[model samples]
Structures are given as structure tokens and as C-alpha cells.
Target: MGDFRRSRLSSTPVVGRVVEWKKTHGWIEPECTIDHPEMAKHQGHIFVHGEDLVPKWRNLVAGAMVEFFLYYDGQGLGAEECTSRKVLRVTLPWKHAKEMFGESGEKLADFEQQTHVTIRAYQWCQPDGNNSDLPFLLFEIWGRPQAVVESIGALAARREQDGNAAEDTLCVNLLLPESRMWKVDLMQLQHYCSLEVSSSITITDPMPCRTLTIQAPLPHFRSSLHALIAQAACVGNLW
Candidate 1:
């Protein structure tokens, strides 16, 4: 019982080995290079040569592998090389994701049980660059809870009226920063059966063009709640 939209585009996965460390153009940090076959000849796929190289953002030096999953919509002149515009969907190995979960490892299982909330992965372009050393990718956490969602809406309204008061009030902040690079929207779904937290990042100069959605069940909401509470508890040294 899933609702899907007809899409005009398609996606594919691509992986390229790092060849060199590229420059950030005074815009982005932790930049590097890849020997992607498609990028070599495509007009849209530009390259950073000798003068354009930056030695500072060379954390992932030559030989570190790079992998990205992109949606390819047929367009541009690289039809021979790759006819599609790269959709900005990136994925890292599961091991990498596990490490990013921090100390919430055991707590994650409890969280999943209490709230049917789900966390999704996403990627976006680097706008200001090295202002943050984090990846453009992020994880989104969201869930479905009818009563809680409606109630929180009102709560947020009240907070807005209270001059947005409080230095340390347990305010139900909808948007929480997982890190400097990613932001999550905590919302309850219509049915309250579960919760869904999806993560995505924008690509290209302006941003990504596709829309994203997450579906969940009631049990998922419980799991999500458990995780959220555990996170707060950990931060408060409750564990």
C-alpha cells in the first residue's frame, strides 16, 4: 500500500578512485579529485588542473576511493559519455554509517522499539566549503504520531508567542542540528502509526531538483521516541 509518483528521471550508482587533491575555489573544504571516466570528457564535468589544485584540503589523499549514487536524467551533451544530469544521491558503506551513530549504538535499538521513527541518509553540495569539515551528506530522523504532531504544532505556536523564550527550556524544537552540516525536522505523521526520518543533500550550484518522502508505521514512532529520549538522556548524562 504505497503511493508513488511517476518520475521523468532515472538514477545510477558510480564509483571512482581518488587520483589527486583538488582545490576548493575558496568555497568548499576537504575537497579532492576522482578519476571518474564520465567526468573526463563531459562539458558539465569540469576538472581541476595544476593551478586549480589545493594542497590544504588533502585529507583524503590520492588512492582513497570515492563512491556516489546519482540519478541520471537524460540531458546535456555528454549523451555519449553519460546523457543524464547527475541526481545528487550519495551513499557510504554501512560500516561508515555505524560509526557515525556515535555512542547511541545500544540506545538506537531501544529507540527503534519505543518510536517508529526512521533515520534516512542524504547528500548535498558544499556551499561555503571548509567552514565545516563534515561531509555534505546527513541523516534525517522523522516519525508519524498524530496526537504528538498536532500537539507539538500548538506547542510551537505557543513558543513563538513567548518571544521564543528560554536559554535552556526543553522546548520542542522541530529542527535540530545533528551537526553543523546537517539539519533534521522532527515531525509526526498523520496516522501516528510510526515515524520516518529521511536524510538527503542537495547537489549542483543551486540545489537538487527531486522531492523526498518517508513512510512509517505506528511501531516506528515508538522506536523513534525511544531513540530521541535516549539521545537527550545521554546528553544530560542520564545513562
Candidate 2:
């Protein structure tokens, strides 16, 4: 079972044009202040760091392109974490990998695989519920606790209200916005599978080009021993 209490730290920052700006409290909005000359006419949405969300960060102006960091920390690998299955363990050119996984191509190959997975990284937050739009770090994962992803999708598919898309890509979908329920459900699914899950991560991106890297207590992940097999099964019918 995956234990989110272990305190793992990771982060990723994306540069994009800010589309809106708002400052409810004393937060500085990045959407209003940060400027991205690279995209003077082109438009793109910045991936807001889930952890950092200060009142000041909200000062950003709409249409201002800025690079906001996404960091994950505080969570650690618990005793009940997901067990790893088979890992492809491929090595490719950094430039080519970056084309697909962004400048931080460290774990590029892991991201391309169409596997069910979820990444647990540190998120910045103030003492209160407030945080900045920038994250301190970032991490990528392709498959994990395969059982968790499979089970959750299955449960959601059973429900009439749940759509087929939700069932097909529950794990991938959750990556955009990691949630507590999904995290808890991942652990629960592990128990049901009776399999030991582990993680295997690699760093391939160069520092000079992309200075984004996470420092953590855990060793650099390679390939996992365990693999998510066909046991879990699909969640719902085909769309």
C-alpha cells in the first residue's frame, strides 16, 4: 500500500501566458504581473503549482505569460504503497525526450507509456488554505499501484452517472489534479490486489537547459520489479 504520509518532495514549473488575474486577499497574482515575451500573440495556459498559492501570487495579470513552479513535498512512501510491476527501462536522447515530456526530460520515457499511474509530490501551501500559483518541484510517473487505478475505474464505471471516459482513464485523469479520495482509494485497491507495488523513476533531463530538479531523501528511481498485469481489468465499456 502507498503511504502518502512518508513525505516525498517533487516539483515542476511551466511557463505560459496568464489568461486571468485576481487578488481576493493580499495575494500577488502571477496572471497579472508575470510577462512572457516568447508568446506575444500565441496563447497558452500555465500549469499552476498545486502547492504554492499565496495571496500575492494571485496578483498575476491575464494574458501575462509567466513560468510558475509546481512542487510536491511532505508526503512520503508509506508501508502500504503500491507495488511496481514491469518497467520498460528505455534510454533515449534527451532532446528527443524533451519534445514529448517538456524540458525536464529526466523521466520522459515513463510519461509516454499508456499505463495507469499517479504521481505523489509535495504541494506548497500556507498555514491556512492559501497558496501561491508556483510549485517548488515536479515529478512524472506512468504506472503505479496498478491495482488502485484499475479498481477505482471499475467502481466509477459501475455507477450510471460516471461516464466511460472517467472509467477508462481514471488514473491518468487524476494526475492533472491529485486528490485525497483518489490517494486513499489507491491504497485501498492495493489491499484488494494482494500484490506488492513499488516505484522506479529516472532522471534524464540536463540541468543547464532545464534547471528544474527535485532533491529528496529517496534514491533516484530506476525500474520497478513488480508490474501491473491484466488482473485488474478494465473499468467500463468502450466509448
Misplaced by over 4 Å in model 2 are 1-38, 41-139, 142-187, 195-239
TM-score of 2: 0.18
Compared with the true structure, all predictions reach lDDT values of 0.29, 0.27
Off by over 4 Å in 1: 1-101, 104-106, 121-132, 135-137, 146-239
lDDT of 2 by residue, 1-239 (tens): 22233332223333233344344211112223234442232242323321233323334344332333422233211111111221111222333334544575445335433334332233345558786343233332223344333322322212222455333221111111111112233343343332222232222222111221111111111101121223221111100
Cα deviation of 191, candidate 2, in Å: 5.4
- Please give the lDDT score for candidate 1: 0.29
Model 2, position 75: C-alpha lDDT score: 28
